[model samples]
Target: MSTLLIKNARNIVTMDGERNVYPGGSLYAEGQRIVAIGYDLPYDKADAVIDAGGKIVYPGMINTHHHLYQNLTRNIPFAQQCGLFDWLLTLYEVWRQLRPEDVYVSAAVGIGELLKSGCTTTSDHFYCFPNGVSGELIDEEIRAAQELGIRFYPTRGSMSLGRSGGGLPPDEVCQDERTILTDTRRVIERYHDADRFSMLRIGVAPCSPFSVTTDLLRESAALARSYGVRMHTHLAETEDEERFCIGRFGLRPLDYMEKHGWIGDDVWFAHGIWFDDGEIARLGHHRCGIAHCPTSNMKLSSGTMPLAKMLKAGVRVGLGVDGSASNDDSNMLLETKIAHLVHRLTDGPTAPGAEDFLKIATVGSARVLGWEDAIGSLEPGKAADLFIIDASKLEFAGALFDDAALPVLTGLSQTVDTTIVGGRIVVMDGALVGVDERKLAESAQAAADRLLGEATFRTKIDYRARRNALSM
Candidate 1:
């Protein structure tokens, strides 16, 4: 049995129940799980001992939502200034050109960015499937996560209704529901690990209300439960979607979701921005989770999510970067920072503080992704997933003088120095291990260039129309 020791020189913010902060603390791990954490632990006998001098260690940030494949199409000029529907319409053509290699490269870039931002575990929603792209898309993402040594949740997302069939995505980008379901099961059978320190998991997500039929959502959720996995989808994102659901389903998004069995502790929806008080109450009652994408919501001009209200109502909420294309940046720390600031702006003086935001980014997100008991804290028997930030950075210089809690320090700006997942170091000194960042960036750009040139893919898109004749 191999063992690793993490000794320190500064502070260790164990985001456990007591939320203890140990000065000059140490953590010990055997295999992939943490064995002990406290001050001045015996660390002489170990395979590896990392001395984190003058830094702050905290639970690694957890990203509950993302579209890793979107990294291949980040900053597309045509979609730079559009709303959700229009943006998807504009990018559908480009996303149609996705190949296995494109997914591979973007997963590298996206996961690398998340690691640098102190996220050790991330869930990626990859729904676009054109030119016969299969679950191999997600396989590539999992492969990248494996090489980087970060915990991964690869949601096998699908769009069953195309523009031709009254959906937002183009015909080429959507897939048959049967094929999607069968492939989802296949991926789960092949990749979903249920072990305590599993490096990978699989979730089933039927893209969104506007892109999938009610049957797909119900069946996907049922299938996920059958395999004991989780469910995820995009819901109540924008006012436009609200109106569309009202007109099409005779109810709002959350009500329609309820009609389709999409509410539960095992299910989470991204961008719960437009839900009403009733809907929020219902989610809390059912224990549904929400993946809060503050930056992406603000970037798309979607309305503010009632985060404080949701929290007050006992909803499970977590922070997410959303998608690389929408966020244009995969930074979980910045997402937490923005979440903290925006919640205060929306909630006035009664708002959540920096500690709340940190919890959402770490433990809260882990719970949203159904990983709470295994990750999200530096507790003994949990996975050794944590990150250390150099508190001496220029952005955080003054805050260290009076900061008592590391979560409080989250409001202060900082960059992560080390990120470890499952007792493995994936990022050290703020750089990705075993990979070339410059080469990854260049390769992503090159793939984006080639994807933009697919004429067949371009012909499949309808930039403004909500539906096309081929929608199922």
Candidate 2:
């Protein structure tokens, strides 16, 4: 029965179907639903009021893919310059040292960063489950997301095939197929709410094509569908992965996955950077989704995703920050900037514009996660999840001419003035509510130090030396 009102002075980027922008706008919310949004409102009545004078409000960015736990393992010197395969090999050695607390703390820190970047909803793909830690890793991530008050779509990611089984991850990090399935079901029953505005939802992800077996993929997708949940996985990310799929499965990545019940609207793949023209058509036909990670793709030299072609081909596309280790940061606004600039460089005039990038992070990403009706844009009866950027800031001075284009063209890499999720203020006045920022940072650093020291895998491989040796 509580009401909150955002009074006006600036612009409101509605991002609705009509692409409306209201000047000197105001919005009112009752509990979790947006009751009204227009140029003016009864500014005198509300339980709480935020004077959004000289600000530009837009739908909060939704992150469709992330490895929140990887926040604890970023900036690793040994793995800094490596590509996908070598990078995973080096990091698996360190990720095996993960404890339950590491998942909790890392997810908290990662979520903190995403909120500051104007992200209100996110799906974390946490597949690394070392021995004795598999039981409660998803629980920890859900707990962190709940505490932070952001809409969470955490995929119950699993890897059932290890190096012993000719997969990429080490033995300790992979789980039995039965265990992964059972845990996925348990989490769905426990945390996955099917209500329209529910905050937490679960998905089934069996890591990547190279890190899991064919049987695991089929079973995970089936389990997810049986529970009325969604399916997620990494597919066709790099050339190396494409080769792996071809050699082992004797088909392209998309073909192999499609045969295993993964080619449908309810399923989405992360780092979808290596599909052919025919495969893109298939994706469009099946209505599958792609979580495009522009920053991670460039960082790993994974090749361009042909985003404009995919969009034109009628395939659903969304934006994700990928893993913290690959992206090195979880900022949706920053991701939007990179996605906008890189696509223009690769796709030319038909590339996505600044407003298009904003839609990708909001409307398109919500479509990928199947939460479009509830979360995406600013409309009546939709969840009140959005962020306000103070247009008066120095960086946004001259860029206010186009409010929709400004966020993507002139990105804000810092914390926003306000971020609201489901009619709740998770962040206000550039600080997180109900969390001790400094203390949590110190805890994350201490935990990272411990994890680095406790890693049994030696960081003995000198990447720079290896490169020099290769040249010789």
Q: lDDT of model 1 at residue 446?
A: 85
Structural similarity to truth (TM-score) of each candidate = 0.94, 0.96
Off by over 4 Å in 1: 402-414, 455-472
Highest-scoring model, lDDT: 2
- Give me the overall lDDT of model 2: 0.88
Per-candidate local distance difference test:
0.84, 0.88
Badly placed stretches (over 4 Å) of model 2 are 456-472
lDDT of 2 by residue, 180-226 (tens): 88888889998999899999988999998888888988888888889
lDDT of 1 by residue, 1-472 (tens): 6787888748888778887878888889998889988876866678877887777788899999999988877776556677888777777777877889988999998899899888999998988888576556788888998888889998999999888888888888888888899889989999999886788899999999999988888889889999999999999999999998998889999989888888888899999998889899999998899999998998888878999889888899999998988999898888887887887888888887777678788889988988888999888899888888777777676578533344344544445788888878888888888888898889988888787766334465433334433222
RMSD per prediction, one decimal?
A: 3.7, 2.0
Location of the lowest summed lDDT over 10 successive residues in candidate 2? 463-472
